[model samples]
Target chain A: MTTQQLYEQIQQKQSFLCIGLDTDMNRIPEHLLQTEDPIFEFNKAIIDATHDLAVSYKPNTAFYEAHGLKGWHSLEKTINYLNQKHPEVFTIADAKRGDIGNTSAMYAKAFLQDMSFDSVTVAPYMGKDSVSPFLAVKNKFTILLALTSNEGAFDFQTQQVGNEELYKKVIKTSQTWESSENLMYVVGATKAEFFKEIREITPHSFLLVPGVGAQGGSLQDVCKYGMNDKVGLLVNSSRGIIYASQGEDFAPAARAAAQKLQQQMAKLLHV
Target chain B: MTTQQLYEQIQQKQSFLCIGLDTDMNRIPEHLLQTEDPIFEFNKAIIDATHDLAVSYKPNTAFYEAHGLKGWHSLEKTINYLNQKHPEVFTIADAKRGDIGNTSAMYAKAFLQDMSFDSVTVAPYMGKDSVSPFLAVKNKFTILLALTSNEGAFDFQTQQVGNEELYKKVIKTSQTWESSENLMYVVGATKAEFFKEIREITPHSFLLVPGVGAQGGSLQDVCKYGMNDKVGLLVNSSRGIIYASQGEDFAPAARAAAQKLQQQMAKLLHV
Candidate 1:
C-alpha cells in the first residue's frame, strides 16, 4: 500500500492506530482453546471487532514462533485472513529480521513478496545491505528499529556515534540508501522527546510507535512532538487491547480498548 | 551446550568450521526436488556427509522463512535431524532476531528451548534487554552481532561511539549484561584485523565468524588474531560449502568443501 493510501485511511478513520496481534495461546479466552487454531480465532475476532478503528494490524512473529510449527501456521492463516477479508487495512509482520546481502533478500522475499505483508520490521545493526533488500521491494515499507521502548534502548541507541546520537544517525544515514523513500521507522512512544529530534531528520516518513498503554508511553506526547501534517504515525497497542478480557466477550472488550485509543487519536487529529 | 563442550568438539574434530545450511529449493540438486521435503532431504545429506569434518552446522533462518510454511517445516526437520543424527555437533540458528524483553524471551524459547539450537544469533541495536533474554536461557549461547562481513557494516559499526568504534563498544558493553558468560560474538572473517582489538575486550568468548569463502575473508588471518587459548571461533561458510555442487555429487562435494576448511583449521590449530 502507498503512504498516501495509508494517510487516506488515517484521515477517513480519524486514527493512525496499528493494533498489534501479539497473541499468545495461554492469554486467549478459555473457550477459544476448544477450537482449532486458537491464535487465529482470537486474531479474527479482534480484527473483526476493531478493523474500522485501526488502520493497520501487526502480528509480531515472536508470539507465533513461540508455538513452533502450529504457531507459524496460525501466522500464515492470520495474514491470509487479513488480506482476503480486509485488504484496505495495512498488515505488518513485526519480524525484526536482518542478515547479510543475499540472506536479507530471502527475508524480504518471504515477508514482502511471498507472505504479502504491507511492511516488516527490520533491525539496522547490520546496516545498508541488510535493510536495502526490504526497501527494494516495491510498494512495501521497511520499519527500521531506532529508539526501542524497552529498557535496553539506553544500552547503545542513545550513545553518541559522532556529533549526533546513534538513533539520529540511524534516521539520517538510512535516507541515503537505495530506495530510501520506501523507508519508515520504529521509534518508541516512551521517548516522546526524541521524536522532535527524529522529526528534524525525517519529517515525512511514518513512525511506528509502540509502548502506548502497557509500556506507559503517553500517546498525546508522541503526537505533540512526532506528528507531521499528514499524521505520519502508527501508534501500536498490543497487550492492552487484545488481552482486555479473557471472558467470552473478549472481542467486544478488545473493540472497547481500541475504541478508547481511537477516540483519543481522533481528538488529536482534529486538534 | 556449554562453552567447554563446544571447545571439546572443536578440538576432537580439529575444526571450528561451521557449515551453514542455507538450503534453497532453487539452488539444490534437481533430484532432491523429486523428494517429498527436498530441503530437509538436502540438509540431511549434507549433515550426514560433513558431520565429522565440521564441529558445527548453522542453518540461516531467512532461507527457511522464504518458502513460508513449507520453509518453516524444513527448518524444523533440519534442526530435528541434526539433534537426532549428529547430536555431538553444535548447532547455530543464524536467526538474527531480537525484540523487547518479553518478546525476545519468546524467540529464545522458540530457538533455544523449543527448537533446541545450541545458540541463536541476535542483533544488539535494541540494547541489553533485547539480547539479555537470550543469554538467560540455561546451557545455551547468544551470539551477538559485533562486526558483520557485509559492506553495510561500515555504515554504523565502525563509527566511533566515544573513544572506541561502535562494534568494539558492542563487544565491550554486552559483557556487562546479566549472565554474560552465555554470550558469544559474531566478528566477520572479512574484518580479520578487528579481531585483535575485539580479543582485547573479551578474550574467552567464542566468535562466530562468517564470510570465509563466499564473502572472501582469510581463514589464516582469523585463526592467527581471533583464536583464544580454547580455540574460540566457529567460522561459518554457507554457499561456499552447501552449493559447492548442485549435482548428483552435491553431498560429497559439500563434504569436500568442508574438509578443505577443516584441514586449514587443523593446520592453524597445530601452528
Candidate 2:
C-alpha cells in the first residue's frame, strides 16, 4: 500500500493504531495449540476482529521465527489472508534486516518481492547500501532505525558524533540516497519527546513507533509531538493486544485491547 | 561453541573457513526448482559436500526469510541436519536480531532456546539492554556487528564520537556485560587494516569476518592483521561459495570454492 493509502485508512478508521502480531505460540490459548498452525489461527482471529479498527498489522518476524518452520508458515498464511481478505490493512515486517550490497539485495527480494510485506524495518548500522536495497522495490518502504525506544538506544544513538546526535545525522544524511523518498523510520514512542527534533529532519516521512502499551508509553504524548498532518504515525502495540489473555476468549480480549487503543486513537484523530 | 572450541576446530580442520549458506532460491540451479523446497535441497547438498572440509555454516536468515514459509522450513531442516549429522560443525543463524530486555529475551528464545542454532548475529543499535539479552543465554554467542564491509559502514560506525571510533567503544563497553566471554564480533574482511586496532580492544574474542570473495577483500591481508594466536577468524564467503555454479555440479563447485578458502586458512593459521 502507498503512504496515501495508509493515510486514507487512518482517516477512515479514525484510528492510527498498528496492531503488532508478535504472536507467541506458547503464550496463546491452549485451544489454538490444537490447530494445525496455532500462530496463524490466532493471527486470523485477531486480524478478523481488529482489521477495521487498525490501519496496519505489524508482525515482528522474531515471533514467527521462534516457532521454526511452523511459525513461518503461519506468517505466510496470515499475510496471504490479509491480502485476500483485508487489503486495506497495511503490513509491516518488523524485521530489522540490513547488511552489505549483495546480501541486502537478497534481503530486499526476500521481504519485498517474495513475502510482499509493505515495509520492513532496517538497521542503519551499515549505512545506505544496506538500506537502499529495500528501497529499490516500488511502493515498499525501508523504515530505518532512527531514535529507538529501548534503553540501549541512548548508547550511540543519542551520542553527539560531530554536531548533532548520531540518530539525527543518520536521518539527515540518509535523505541523500536514491529511493529515500520511500524511506520511513522507527522512532520509538518512548522517545516521543524527541519527535519534534525528528520532524525537523524528516518531517514528511512516517514513523513506526513501538513501545506504547506494555512498554508504558503514553499515546497522547506520542500524538502530541509525533503526529503529522498526514497522520504519519504507525503506533504499534504488540504484547498488550495479542497476548492480552491466554484463555479461549483471547481473541475477544485481543479485540478489547485493540479497541481501547483504537478508541483512544479515534479521539486523537478527533473522530 | 566457545572461542576455544572454534579455535580447536580451526586446528582440526586446518582451516578457518565459515561457508555462508545464503541460499537464494533464484540463484540456485533450475533443477532444484522442481523440488518442493529448493533452498533446503541446495543447502543439504552443499553441507553434505563441505561439512568436514569447513568448520562453520553461517545461514543468512534473509535468504531463508525471503521465501517465507519454505525458507524458514529450509533453515530448520538445514540446522537439524547439521546438529544430527555433524554435531561438531558450528552453526550460526545470521539473523542480526536484538531488541529491548523483554523483546530481546523473546528473540533469544526464538533463535537460541527454541531453535538449535549455536549463535545469532545481533545489531547493537539499542545498546546494552538489547545486546545483553542475547548474552543472557548460556552457551550461545552474540556476534555483534562491530565494523561491516559495506560502503555505508563509514556513515556512522567509523565516526569519532568522543575519543574512540563508535565500533571501538561498542567493543570496549561490551566487556562490562555478563557472559562477555560469549561475545564475538563481525569485523568485515575489507576492513582488514582495522584489525590491529580491534585486536587491541578485543584480543581474546572471536571475529566473524565476511566480505572476502564477492566483495574484493584479500585473505592474505586479513590474516596478516586479524588472525590471533588461536586463529580466531570465521572468515565467511557467502555468494562466492554457495552460488559458485548454477549447474547440477553446484555442490562440487561449492566444495571447490570452500577447499580453496580452507587451503588459504590452513596457511593463515600456520603463519
Candidate 3:
C-alpha cells in the first residue's frame, strides 16, 4: 500500500520482515499435492503459520506460474485469503511487470484491482510510462528494480558509463516521474553494502530487499546499512522459510524460520 | 524457435509480418462474448482468418492476464490452436518476464516449456542471470527490451550519463553472456532512426518490433534501417490488427489488416 501504512505496521509489530512465498511445486510437501489446489493449500498454511510474524508476504509470481493455470489460481486464492484473513499483512505480487503505458495500466488493474495485491514489483527499463501506470493506482506502490542481488546484476546494473552507476541513475531519474511519492525500489540484500549509496539516492522510499536466507545474504549486514528511521526495509527470505522441511512439519518449520527473522527484525528496529 | 527456422518461415511466406493477438474482452465482437471463453474464440477466429498472411502471432500476455483464469486458459487454447492448425507460424508469449536466476528459470519453464510458446519478451534491467535463464531453454529465445516505442521509454532508455545511452550500453554488454545466441531484442518501430545503430551492436539477432500502428510508428522507416540480410524483423501490429473492427466482421477485418502489412513486407523483401 502506502509507505505510511507500512511504517505503522513495522512500528506496531516491531518487525520489517517480509516473508517471500516463492513456492516450488517439487519442493512443497508431497502430502499437500493430494489436495485439489496444492499450491494454494501450501500458501494458505504458510500465510496462516507466519502471518503475524511477517509484515508482508511477497509471492514471486514466477513460482506459481510454473504450474500453469493451477498456479495462477493459487496466486488468486492466496491473495484472496490474505485479504480475508490477514488484512494487516501487506501483499506484494513479485511479478516484475512493466510494459507500454496502456498495457501497464491493465497490469496495474489486474494485480491491484482484480487480484487485490497491495503492490506489484515493476521493471524500470521501459522507463516512466511502464512504471507510472502502477503508481497511478491509489494505495498501490510501484517497487521499481534498482539494484538486484544476483551475481549477474553486476553485469549491467553496476556498469559505469560516465561517472555514476546505471542503477543510481535509474533511481534518480525515476524520482522525477508523476506520483513518485508512491514509488519504492528493489535493492537486493546481497548488495547490502550499496544500501548507504542507495539511501542517498532514494532516502525515504521503502526497499524490497530480496536475496537473503538461501541466497546467502546476511540479515545483520543488510540491516546495518539499509534501515531507515521508519524501518524502511522489507527483507525477504523465500526458500529458507517455505522449504524448511520436506514433510508435513513444513508449515510449522516455515513459521519458525519466519519467526526467527521477525525476532531479528524486532531487535533491528529497536534502535 | 531458432532464428534459422523463423527465417525460413518468413522466406516461405515472403512476409515479415507478426500479427499481434492483443485480444481484449471489451473489443471482441458481441457474438464471441456470448461464448464460454470469448478470448479463445476471438483468437481462433483471427488465427483462422489470417494464418496464411502472417509468419508469427505475438499474443500480448496482458490481454489474457486481464481476464484472470479464463484469460490464461484462452492463452493456452490459442497457442494450442496455433500448434495444431498452423504449426509453421511462430508463437510468442509477449510476457516481459525477468527476475533472479532460479525465479527466471521457472518463468522460462512456464512460457517456453510448459506453455510451449517459442519465445518471450524480457526486461534486461536485471542483467545476465535474469536473461540467461530464459536463453538456457532449448528452441526458445529471450527477446530483451532494447529501445521501446512508448513516450516514457525516453525517460531512462535515452538518458545519457557520459557518452552512450543506457540502452546502447545494455545491448553492448549483454553480448558476452552465456547462450546469447538465443537472445533476440525488442526495438520499437517508433525509434526507427536508432535502427542502424542497433544493427551495428546486434547484427544477426531477430528484433521483436512493436509500435507499428496504434502507437504511430512508420512501417516504411522500420524496414529501411532495421532490416538485415536475414529478414530479421518481427514487426508487430496489435490494436491495428486485432481491433480493426468491433463488430462480427472483426476476424475478417483482422485478416485484411494482416494482409496490408504482409503486402508491404513482401514489397520490402522484393518478393
Candidate 4:
C-alpha cells in the first residue's frame, strides 16, 4: 500500500488505528482450541469484526512464533486471509527484524514480498544497511524503532548521540539513506511528550505508536504532539483491543473496544 | 548449552569456528534443487561435513525466511538435524530478534525452548526489557550486537553516547541487567581493534565474531586482542565456508574451508 492510500484509509475510516494481532493460543477463548488453527480463527473473526473500524492490522510475529511451526502456519493463514478478505486494509508485520544487508533483504522478502505485508518493523541499531534493504522494496515500508514504549527505551535510545538524542540522530541520518522516502518510525505512545521532539526530526514521516490502551499512554497527548496534516500516526492497541473478552463473544467485544478507539479518533480527526 | 560446556567444546575442538548456515537456494548447487527440501539438504550436507571442525553453527534466519513457509520448514528441519546429529555442537539461531518484554519472551520461546537452539542473536536497540527475557531462559545465550561488521555500524554504534561510544555504553549498561551471566557479545572481527575496548567491559563473556573471511577480517588479529583465557570467540565464516564451491563437491569444498579455519584456530590454541 502507498502512503497516500494509507492516508486515504485513515481519512475514510476516521481512524488511524492499527489493531495488533498478538494472539496467544493460551489467551484465546477455550472453545477455539478445538479448531484446526485457533490463532487464525481468532484473528479472522477479529479482523472480520473490526476491519472497518481500523485502517490497519499489525500482527506481532513473536506471538505466532512462540508456538513453533504450527504458529508460523497460523501466521501464514492469517496473512492470507487478510489479503483475500480485506485488501483495502493496510498490513504491518510487526516483526522487529534487522540484520546485515543481505540478511535484511531476506527479511524484507519474507514479510513484504512473500507474505505480502505492507510494512515490517526494523531495529536501527545496525543502521543504514539493515534498514535500507526494507526501503529498497517498492511500495513497502520499513518502520524503524525510535522511542519504544518499554522501560528498556532508556537504555540507549534516549542517550545523547552527539548533541542530539540517539533516536533523533536515527531519524535525521536515516532520511539521507537510499529510498528513505518509504521510511516510517515506531515511536512509543507512552512517551507522548517525546513526539514533539520526534516530529521536529521527522515532521512528515508516519509514526507507529504502540503504547496506547494497556501500556497507559494518552491518545490526546499523542495526537496533540504527533499528528501532522496527513494524520501521520498509527496508534496501535494490541492486548487492550484483541483480548477484550475471553468468551464466545470475543470478536464482538473486540469490535466494541476498537469502536470506542475509532470514535475517539473520529473526534480527533473531526470526521 | 552452558558457558562451561561451550568452553569445553572450544577446548576439545581447538576451534571456535562458527559455520554460518546462510543457505540460500540460489547459491547452493543446482543439483540440490532436485531434493524435497533443498535448503535443509544443503545445510545437512554442510553440517555433516564440518561438524567436527566448527564448534558452532549459526543459521542466519533471513536466508530461510526468504522462501516463506517452505523456508521456515527448512529452518526447523535444519535445527532438528543439528540437535539430533551433532548434540555437542553449539547451535546459534542468528535471527537478530528483539522486542518488548512479553514479546521478547515469546521470541525466547521460539528460538530457545521450541527449536532447542543454544543461543539466538539479538539486536540491543530496544534495551533491557527486550534482552532480559532472552536471558531468563536457562542454559540459553543472548548474543547481543555490540559492534557489527557492516559499514552501517558507524551510523549509530560509533557515535559518542557520553564519554564512550554507543556500543561501549551498550556493553556497559547491558552487564547490569538481570541474568547478565548468560549474555555474550557480538563484536565483529572486522573491528578487531574495538575488541580491546569491548574486552575491557566484558572480560569473560564469549563474543561471536562474524566477518572473518567473506567480509575480510583477520583471525590472527581477532584472536590476539579478543581471546580470553577460555578462547572466548566464535569466529563465523559463512560464504567463505558454505559456498566455497557451487559444484557437486560443494560439501567437501565447504569442509576444506572450515578445516583451514579450524587449523588456524588450533595453532592459536596451541593444541
| TM-score of candidate 4 against the unseen true structure | 0.99
Model 4, B145-255: lDDT tens digits are 999999999999999988999999998899998899989989888888988888889999999999999799999999999999888899999999999999999999999
TM-score on alpha carbons, each prediction: 0.99, 0.94, 0.97, 0.99
User: Which sequence of candidate numbers ranks them by DockQ, best first?
Assistant: 1, 4, 3, 2
Summed over model 4, clashes come to 0
Instruction: Return the lDDT, model 4, position B212.
Output: 93
Worst 10 residues of 4 chain B by lDDT: B64-73
How high is the lDDT of residue A44 in model 3? 91
Interface RMSD against the true structure, candidate 4: 0.8
lDDT of each: 0.93, 0.86, 0.87, 0.92
Give model 4's DockQ, 2 decimals: 0.90
True contacts kept of each: 0.94, 0.79, 0.80, 0.93
Using lDDT as the measure, the top candidate is 1
Q: lDDT score, residue A4, model 3?
A: 84
At residue A94, candidate 1 shows an lDDT of: 99
Candidate 3 residue A169 Cα shift, in angstroms, is: 1.6
TM-score of candidate 3 on Cα atoms, chains taken together: 0.97
State which docking tier applies to candidate 3. Answer: medium
